[model samples]
Target: MSEILSAPAPQVGNAESWTRREILQQPETLRATQALLRARQAAIEAFLSPLLARNDLRIVLTGAGSSAFIGDSLAPWLSMVMGRSIEAIATTDIVSAPALHLRAGAPTLLVSFGRSGNSPESAAAVDLTEALVDSPHHLIITCNAEGDLARRAGANTHVVVLPDATHDRAFAMTSSFTAMMFAALSIFSGIATMEARAEVIAKALADTLMDADQRMAALVEHGFERVVYLGSGALKGLAREASLKLLELTAGALVTAFDTPLGFRHGPKSIVTDRTLIVVFVSNDPLTRRYDCDMIEELRAEARCGAVLAVSAQPMEGDALHIPHLEDAADADLLIPFILPAQLFGLHASLKLGLMPDTPSPSGTVNRVVQGVRIHAIGA
Candidate 1:
């Protein structure tokens, strides 16, 4: 391991701390994540065994904010691997325009993600799906065991509670996002044995965790004024979460933006400057990775940005790339491994800027469940 790979891991919890201790320590969160995966698998096997057997089942993964992005990452892989049609739809849009998003009579499986599970939109979307669609089944994945969504799940719904620690105490979600994403991947892997997937997932996670433990301190110390995250295809949502992590963790001291690789050159590239830190999520797919590599190389040569970092699985052949993927590593779901870097980056940035990583927002401007938005009924 390089010097950058041996930094002290964040401590998880203690008696003195309320908010901050929750995420810095990993044991509880990791356990919770693993439990959530098991529960999700059980729920899917119980509810979806027969439905998935049918070819006409249309799977719709839905949520808001980080929750919504969980769907984006898993949709493509699940669609191809399981031979079922899957799409990620945002709950906000689903609430505002249910007819446009929901089909009238399709056998739809709406998989929802949430940290608190109490978000107004989450509940409303489920209600809307029932009203607008014929015979819909729901799979609710949430961190808050006592949340309304979990309580509302009846015989018709399959509800799985994520590990309690996944109900993050911080303003931004660190463990919850990755845990829910992993749960989604596990549920999709019903086509294969869960234990086999777990073996690969465990190896990938351990490696990333060890790498993040080392590199985070330096990335935070570099202290760029702004950060830009770039990804292509399904990764655009991960890019969004990565950008949001920095912004929220630092309480807006660090401005952030996200764009797809090809999308950036059109106009978003203007955001890159000497004080900006650019982090690119290289695609596993060869074609997409080529464009991602091209953009990073161009930026590195421009000397316009403070730093250009590639969080990649495959090593980039230069001094600039940060390769967390280990040699002889077992192949696993891509989303499982890529999330650790983003999680650690947010934690380090939060701590470096003197904001409590657990409670970045002391005044509660942003919250676990977003507040102050009234839910209005829409017309039929």
Candidate 2:
């Protein structure tokens, strides 16, 4: 196999490429997102105050693909914080079957995350919630201000726009995903303390990026044929996003699998091979971390996977991809930091395959924003 540089930086505004610059710029983008949210705290509070106080309120986090995963990471943490039931549903599913996911007469807050804000389902899901539920309010978090979602937002909607840079030019979502995920968490966690938490996280991420890029490059050079990602709780959603990142950038040239640490043994563990790379998201919880560490040792004993790497904030007795001070943060906060290494891996893996990280698929089968889907009239 030929050796190649993974995610070499791209000159801005040039048509030549994207992934490297966008992926590397994530920590800065997150800082900007936090500032943007902080500036709008008054408006956010005015809109959410009465609605949140309602005992019947239901929160549904909906988006498509990577966007939907934002909900997956947030739903578990936010539900615990807000003391309400929240669900992460894909807009693709909600647009297809609105009645099944939504209930009429429910006071609902539909939080939609979209990078371009123009996906057919972004708008369609909003319509479905409005039509199916008697009372529906919206909090639209998108990078694109000119796109459909931004344009269609009404009085019932409060739009939180991110920095224009997060509308990434790269085919894969990087900065956009992290920034939006952070924004959603801050919005629901009470905007007052967001600045303090974001400060700690942003600084930690900046330091991690400095250390992560080279380590990820070495992993890409290992020449693995397949990759498996394992995580528990909120981190599981991140594992799903990480798997999709590699699968997309490599154009399916590299096979991928994602599951909870315990869930892997049920049947998914069969995907492991000597040519495979295993990426584990080590949890902060003592009990959960035991399961995560157990899987790492189990796979190490089997000696099947090409290498086993642990991504943890704290180091135990041995080597791991330790992020700085992650153990002190809540499980919800770890979502942002844990995602960076996976993003770096995907960027490098694309180059390792001799594929353009910007647009790997020349056949037009997959696209930046999905195309060729004719929306069926579900009367949402």
Candidate 3:
């Protein structure tokens, strides 16, 4: 008998309905965020208004898991575009070693990303930073309106809430990740205001959904046992997310792994077996694309997996086995579009594995906002 890995296929329209419903439900979060962002923009303006705006404004971008990847994606862009000092540090790291990530008596901004406001380390990081730093301003981005972080921004801090629908009921973060990311990008840069930029972003998202629905539908039909994801540069974060979405949404029925394109050659490539599904997130930058495409070609030549899929922002020169190219996706924002595809794949896998996409683990092994974490008061 053939091996069965994924859950049953969800009702055909279920994915589309969830997508639309989640987007509609997020308006309040989005609007409130607009207000919070404007306020943050004002506060930042005020803080810098007195002193000359320095390129050295230290920023620590943090979160756990998917939330951590949000920081990874934003840090480089903030550093290059805003020309500020930024680092993507996991709250776990700060919780373990505060001295390494913090500087005393320096003006620092802590941008914390959380889907549920209650991750233990998240609250702890804030407390630890306040305990150690001279002056720290916080910008909390979260999907849960009632989350501890969102409600606890206090008088001096800024809280930006994403769409309520972004609180992703599923085990994985589908809408929340993109919503929080866009909110951060909008806050730090004026990407939201540019008509052309908005158009491109919107188009990229639309195309991603339409194409992913078709491709993932077919992929899950194939029913592979294991999946390996690979990428480099900003795409590395995308690969991490893709790996998690597959693992989480499918409840680990499909074993998943991730590594940088070159990093995999060291030993991780051994994980690629005949039953594995290899998915590559190709880059848009010229230099990065060369490395990304080379790996895809190498994998195809080896044929180590049941299937090899490449999701790229642009078309590649050779005849490669992959899904459609996400055309005109010239920016890292292109990752936002690719996320829909991965999400669709996860959703389909969950259903194929006889799980519910809306609430996969009825046992409550996971939650929309994490539970069992307590908040403590730390003195300044």
Q: Which candidate is the best by TM-score?
A: 2
Provide the TM-score for each candidate, comma-separated.
0.86, 0.94, 0.83
lDDT of 2 by residue, 34-130 (tens): 8888888999989988888899998899999999999997898788888888999999999888879998988899999999998888888998788
Arranged by TM-score with the best first, the candidates are 2, 1, 3
lDDT of predicted model 2 = 0.86
How accurate locally is residue 178 in candidate 2, as Cα lDDT from 0 to 100?
93
Deviation in angstroms for 198 in model 2? 0.8
Q: How do the residues 44-152 of candidate 1 rate in per-residue lDDT, one tens digit apiece?
A: 6878787778787778999988899888777766777777678999899899888799998787888989889999999999998888888788888888988978887
Which one wins by TM-score: 1 or 3?
A: 1
Deviation (Å) of 266 in candidate 2: 0.1
- TM accuracy, model 2: 0.94
Q: C-alpha displacement of 344 in model 1, angstroms? A: 2.0
Off by over 4 Å in 2: 1-16
In model 3, what lDDT does residue 329 have? Answer: 47
RMSD of 2: 4.3
lDDT of 1 at 185: 72
Q: Using lDDT as the measure, what is the rank order of every candidate, best first?
A: 2, 1, 3
